[model samples]
Target: MFRLAHISDVHLGPLPAVTYRDLASKRVVGYVNWQRNRRRHMVDALTDTLVADLKASEPGHIAVTGDLVNLALDGEIELARLWLETLGPPHDVSLVPGNHDAYVPGAFGKACRSWSAWMSGDGEEGPVSRDTFPYLRVRENIALIGVSTARATAPFMASGFFREGQAARLEKILEETAGRGLCRVVMIHHPPVRGAVSQHKRLFGVGRFQKAMRRCGAELILHGHSHLPSLYHLDGAGGKIPVVGVAAAGQAPGGSHPAAQYNLLDIDGGKGDWRIRLTRRGLTGTALPLADLEAVELSGKAAAFVRN
Candidate 1:
């Protein structure tokens, strides 16, 4: 069985010093919000503990869906790179950016440059850019597709965009991967399903995304950005595909958002008869040990049994 661990919206904290120029644009709003609210809840220590627990589980691979940094400041981006190194090497970890990584107009490009190793496709080399997304990485019998929905948005809005160009490319990738008889796992920062998040935080072009899924199905879809532990399904050419979201990895226990958590997916079998078991684990409180919260069989003859 291939064990894949999923984590997202880490929002790595302990804000780096910000210059006046950094605060001149939309970052000022994020800076203010972090100071007033986020800093209290997004604790670095919590993320550290969560990562340690995840590593102990020894997943065959790890998928981080985004929001690695808070303000997308140059310092924050650098710190995030260091954090990624501690998490695992590029071969073992795959990442996609989130809205916070592209908080300003050019921040996403900077992040791409710094985090090229984790985001690049197999055998892909040279400088990574924003356009390099929807990259493919094959591990064992699974095909991991990284899609980018992250973009700069206006202050107070956390929306993401899925343009037609990317949608077309995604459909092609899905088709090719399916033809290979590999389990296709698509990763995006924003949940593609409608109503997964509020209006200001919604992923635009939901119709286009659904259309692509209908044309070329995926085995599993993983996303972050809502900071809520959620599960949903989308219609696929073959059957229902599971879409999952997890809470922020850095969120503190007893905070406004759900506590830090990650999903461990055990995938076995092949092509037309895959078996998937999902085990959800995370913190229930500050003093309690990390523990299993839910376990369900996502595929096979049994119906999906999910708790919250």
Candidate 2:
């Protein structure tokens, strides 16, 4: 079995000193919110403990579904680059940015440059200067597809966007990978089903996303902008595509949101048939080991929701 771990919305913190210029735009409100409330909830200590436990399990590959920084400050991007190295080398980890990672007009480019190695395509001959998704990383028998729904918006907006061009390219990638009998797993920052999140925080291209999947097909989908642990499925041409949303990896317990958690997926089989076992390890009051959480098995090709 190929063991893969999924974590998202790390939101690395302790805001670096900001100049009036840095907070001159919509970021000023974000800075105020961070000082007033976010500092209390999203703590680095919680993230440190979670990372230690995550590394101990030692999965073959890790998928980080973004929000690595809060305000997308220049310093935050650099700090997050170091943080990504601590997770694992670029080859071992695949990442897609979330809304927070794209939190301003020009911050997305900086974030991409900092995390480029972790987001490159397997076919690339050399290192990428900037990230262009949906990038494909074909590992073992699984095709890891990284899509970006991360886009900066105005104040009070936490939305994501995936344009038509990206959708068309993603469909082609899905077709090629599926034809190779690989389990195609698409990772993005925003949920891609109707009613997955509030309107303001939703993926504007959910309809386009579903349309692309309906045309092609993928075995699984993973996203993290909502900061909630949720499971939704799409009836794809090949079978049901499972779309899962993970809570913020650094979030503490007993708040309006769920505690920090991550999912480990054990996938096996090939071609027309694939089997997957999902294990969710998380922190309630204290952190739990991998064996502590219940495991759900996805057996047979089309029956993704079956717990078995």
Candidate 3:
């Protein structure tokens, strides 16, 4: 059995500073307004609450899908590192980058150039350089495949790609590791399977990406970008693989809604079968299971959703 804590879209910061472009369409002119007008202080309180809750519910591993920073500011990256440190250590935590983490060309360039130096710390092991793609982490019975989809998106295009090269590398890695029979968990910033928001630029190559995952079996696909909690069951070439999406860690709900959110995936094995307990962050600080959320589960996976 493996317990994993999944979080995303922290958007760490020294708030109320800079006019930066967002990964989505259009230039966001008001960082100050976003912080002041949108109940940003609620987000801060939610962050502190979430962190405290994570400490109480300790998990074997932590997976952060992306958007650790708002503007990709250097200072914000450091702030992100501090936030990760709070989880435990880099070895205990795994991460991929989101579009917001590399909102512009320069941020990607910097991350590529100093990939190791930037993420340097005690007990942290990962791709030492930008050239290293399809980074695989094998821990206990879990095999985590972390991919980089953070790129300099165009003005109107928020999509991401692994391209042919990265995709081929991933295939080889999966083929090699399949015989191990470990639970394969794939982490990416963008959601691959289609949804109401699938037509957006953030999922440009979603069809191709889904095809690739089907070719090389994936147990669970975890991602963040839409800021809404989602779980989709992909019924195709590889039986049923679930794609779980988490909301922004600290972004306040636009109206009367939850201020913070996360996902807790509890997997237990018995009689050689695996059962998953999927919980969504609720508005009243309750961890609501998908079985109770007929509106959220929306598909075949709902039958398998367990309340815990």
lDDT (tens digit, per residue) of candidate 1 on 1-308? 99999999999878988899989999999999999989898988888888899999999999999999988999999999999999999999999999999999999999999999999999899777766778999999999999999999999999999998889889989999999999999999999999989999999988999989888999899999999888888988888888989999988877788999999999999999988888888987776568888888889434477665
201 Cα displacement, candidate 3 (Å): 3.8
- Per-residue error at 284 for model 1, in Å? 1.6
Residues 178-219, model 3: lDDT tens digits: 667666778888887666354544566666677777788766
Better of 1 and 2 by TM-score: 1
- Per-residue accuracy of model 2 over 1-308 as CA lDDT, tens digit each: 89888999898899999999998888998898988877888978878877777778788899999899989999999999999999999899999888888899888888877888898888675544323688999889999999998888999999989898888889989999988889999999888987888988988888899999888978888889888878778878877777877878888877678788888888999887788777777775654542335456666443334331
| Total residue pair clashes for candidate 3 | 1
lDDT (C-alpha, whole model) for all candidates: 0.91, 0.84, 0.64
In model 1, which runs have C-alpha deviations exceeding 4 angstroms?
300-303, 306-308
Q: Which has the greatest TM-score?
A: 1
Give the clashing residue pairs of candidate 3, or none. Answer: 159-201
Reference-based TM-score, model 2: 0.94
